[model samples]
Target: IVSDSSVLLCVCISLCLAWLHGDPRKVLHPTDSYGRFCGQKGTPNAKKPILFYFNILKCANPAVLINLQCPTTQMCVLKCPDRFATYTDMQLQHKLSKSYWEYYRQFCKPGFNDPNKGDFHIFRPNLLMCVCVCVCVCVCVCVCVCVCVCVSYRGLLISLVVSLVFILLLRFTARLLLWFTIIAVIFLLAYGMWYCSMELSQLRETPGSDVAIVDVGLHTDLQVYLQLRQTWIIFLVSLGLTEVSILVMLIFLRRRVQVAIALLREASRAMSYIMSTLFYPVVTFFLLAVCISYWAVTAVFLASSNEAVYKHTFLVNTFFSLCQTFNRTNISKTASCLGSQCTFAFYGGETPYHRYLFILQLFNLLVFLWLVNFSLALEQCTLAGAFASYYWAKRKPQDIPPCPLFSSFSRAIRYHTGSLAFGALILSVVQLVRIILEYLDQKLRGSNNMVSRFILCCLKCCFWCLERFIRYMNRNAYIMVAIYGKNFCTSAQEAFFLLMRNVVRVAVLDRVTDFLLFLGKVLIAGGVGIVAFFFFTRKIPVIQEEVPTLNNYWVPLLTVVAGSYLIAHGFFSVYAMCVDTLFLCFCDDLERNDGGSEKPFLMSPELHRILGKSSHSRISPLQILLVWDKCLPSSNSKMLQVRIKEPKTTEEMCHPSNMSVKILSHSGHSISRGNKSNTTTPQVYLLTSHPGSVLRFSKKDLQSTAHLIFQTHVHTKTA
Candidate 1:
């Protein structure tokens, strides 16, 4: 027995030594031919324990192995390396390959791997530590909440009511503004029409006489006549179109228009909500930089690829042309150049200049599409995060979720690349088609062939309508993707279905919202233009005298208007996106909850409460009582009980009139009373709660149902 014990002790000691040393295969240092450590030259630590060697090696250092060891008396420890630190080729090649670097650069640290210099590391130090901290905070919060609830529930209730009231007041103010703007727009349009009619009538009397008098040595009477004729034609056509639009709106599409306007209003509200957060401006600026960069890159590519062809094409000259037009430069000189030098500019091109220009335009179209799509996705995702956070905060006011803006934005850029690209590609193709049609129309404008022009016009109109519809659908689809994390197609289909299901609501809300937004845009742009005019003319009077050549106030007015439009678009686009997102969310909530007792509303309590109050007056008392009762717990039997007086007449008994049902017990049982006898008037009671439990009865039987019973009521009365 002693001999066997000695052998077992020896084995146990060996195992302990092995464990302390750890497995040889797990060691990080390279071994020599004799399977010994490749020690530093002339170092006395060559024979140091392998456990100590690994303990100093950094975590995530490719030079280090998977597992490390320490002496049995000490704990094994590893220090994480700086993520932004440079690694040796050997280290990176072995552990962090090229593919891994690509992923790391994209998701882990963008712009970090630039050869010139590494960016600052922005990653969280330790996920585990963060999680632990968050958990502790939540626990503390819960404890604090419990104490508050126990101590001052009444105070909390009062505060909540005050907040809700403030919100209601703000909502009311917004609605009043919306209605005021709509009425203002209508009046403005009417006044403008009256002014236009007066001007046109005056113009008809004068015609080319005024133009001839204004024409200097530059133009003859013939040129004046042609210009006046063209102006008249354009004005008449515009007036006719406006009249047609008004007729169509008033006669056939009034409801649809209203719906569109409502949708716009909703969008505006959503925009206000989203912009209220700081994340919006940050995301907007970032996206704007990205878009500008993309545009520059695309322009460079197009210019570099087909320099000669692109130089003469609209692709290169479009912005310049707009600038020239805005500056009111001599169009006659431009026209002369177009007829002479510009016609032969592409003659010496290597490729068919038109084809090359077409290809370059196509490439640009794709780039623009990608930029727009990416920006849209970014905005949608950010808004989604904002909406989600808002919703979560509303649902659990004490435990608000963290701002998910960056996280959601990153997720969208990473996961939804394909969806974004696909959506953008579709829209880009449609836009390209529109561009082509416009180019064709411009080319054919000088042609007198009415049939071709008419055909082009019809095609353009159809495509314009189609484009608007697709754009709207695509936008809503993006909202769905943000909320539900679905692919583009699935999200689009779901959005379409949701819209269809709530068509009436969507129509009414959409039109009203759109009109409100339109009114806001007009007000903003017009107000800015008017203010700018006064500022430039009256405030800066020296500017008019100093720059006499710039005599036209029209140019500055138009510039201000254009600038205001851009500003409004930027500001309102965010609101529009918010509206779409929230509307979709509201629609989703309706589908999921159906305003039933079985499911609570997913909307914010304030919104739900406000909407309920607004619409409550329209609902019948029975519906309100029934729905309220259904939502209540069965423990409130005193409130649920209702008594109806038995009828004394034989005719009433035969008809079984004025029967009232009272929910009596927790087992889905109800007590229904009716008079079954002519003289004694014995009460007939039913126990089942189901609607089907009642026997077939005429309308008269239901009409006779009576008063509800309550604890305060001493006698039954007719309902």
Candidate 2:
């Protein structure tokens, strides 16, 4: 088709050129392969078919050889090879003749003269929008954080409100109720005096008499009794009653003072064991959290039956809610996380079985979060580990040495015991106030009828509290020695001795503070007793008698209460002194047993109290490792919402709601790499000594509910 058109164009051009004298050039049609103007007699109308044949031939398969002849009016065109014949590899066999595939190769090259190798950039608006989006998210996060911080810092109201909310949510609280009591007492006293004055004025004047008349009497016993009016007798009786009341108050105050002294004296002893208690208000909240946790845990362990489980759980929760606020004080999760701890971070002991405890711990945390969403939490993540990590990260290797924490049990005992004492002192004050309030309310309402019942109740309460303290102390003592050592450590004993010596040196306050406290007691006692006497004389005309009644029951009863108070006060003071002496004796005796160098004492009231009681070393906080175990005790039917180490494998459609557990072998042993006893060590070398194994393993935290726990394994020899 191209040849025919070219022949026609050539003939026309030749004839026209002969007519017009023109020149011809084939260079302009370099892209065209068809023979240019070969036949001079070509018609212009036949050019279309020649061009179409040239296009078809250009795309023809190279594998086939085509032989063709064309007329004088036709044009010959060579075919271009198929585009699929491009060279993937430079190997010679697969290569095609370069010329035959030129059009195809050129077409595949993308553009006729693209200098940019596929790296060519078509127009793109720069994605500043993406950067803008990233910037916006960052800005949003930062703004939210800033707002939170600003609100937290700016609002004292927030602090106050949160504190109040937390305090109210607590199950046990020590509230300051003195302001209300003092106000009530002041108003009552004012009202009583005003009423008394009115009554007395009316009594003095005869009801129908125009003027007040004085009854004339000669200087007889009658005149003496009426005007001076056995009132001197009333005065003497009141004084006696006042003395008795002072004595009783002195006793109560004395005990409180003694407990406070004991706590101050033993400050070095009880740091670790105290169950940091919330005030009464939020005790319920804490309890609620525990109950919720337990309920969820129980549901998982006992999967199937809903009736028995829900019924029992409800009853338990109700009982827990109704329980006295004080009962919620001592529960702690610190012991459980490290229970059955392995020898090293990545190692287990005895059995070939491998347990990735840390992962298991994650499960525990999951359960905890699921069960108890909100509570006063001490997360293990926040404790010593984070600070240690941070400090180490910042610190130089040369600067590092030992980070000594709590090293022994004797020391722990002393520190924790002191803490307990301090806590007890505060608790005692709370108890005293509570009793006083209860007493006042009861007497005013006449609920118990007996006026003396208030004192009896107070005494009973005191006894119960003391007993509880002793029991707790004893339990901790046994546990400490078993877990760590006989004492927190040996230096602990020396510290106690030093503490005692200082206490003795500062004996100056032995009588001073006591005297002041005694004064407060005396004032309260005397005021109450005299006021009562006045009440009986002026107001209660029920037991009226012509002569001074020999049978004034109020006098004898008041006397008994007062006398008991005084005697009890004095004797208890002596008993307190004796207890202090006992503590001092123990310290002295222990010192002699140790044969350690003694230091001279520095006098201070704190030192004196400490000396009087006993001296013990302080516990290094490091020794007291706090672990997070968010699991319910097995004694409870409900489990805490924590992942169990043992996953339930079988479908427990049959597992009853109340999980029945049986005890299996629960045994433990301690393995120390070094010498077992470092007992007779001196102070300087003491820190270097290889103290044998101190293992605290427990089966309580294991997946098996039936296994026994080894709380006593390291501490004692079983019978």
Task: Please state the error at residue 498 of candidate 1 in Å.
Answer: 1.6
**Reference-based TM-score of each model:** 0.49, 0.19
Candidate 2, lDDT over the whole model: 0.31
| Models, CA RMSD each | 28.1, 44.9
In model 2, which regions exceed 4 Å deviation?
A: 1-500, 503-509, 512-535, 538-562, 570-574, 589-688, 692-719
Among all windows of 10 consecutive residues in model 2, the one with the lowest summed lDDT is 304-313
Instruction: Give per-residue CA lDDT, model 1, range 417-512, as digits (tens).
Output: 667666766776788789889978878889999999999999999989988888888778777777777788898999999999878667766665
Question: What lDDT does model 1 reach?
Answer: 0.47
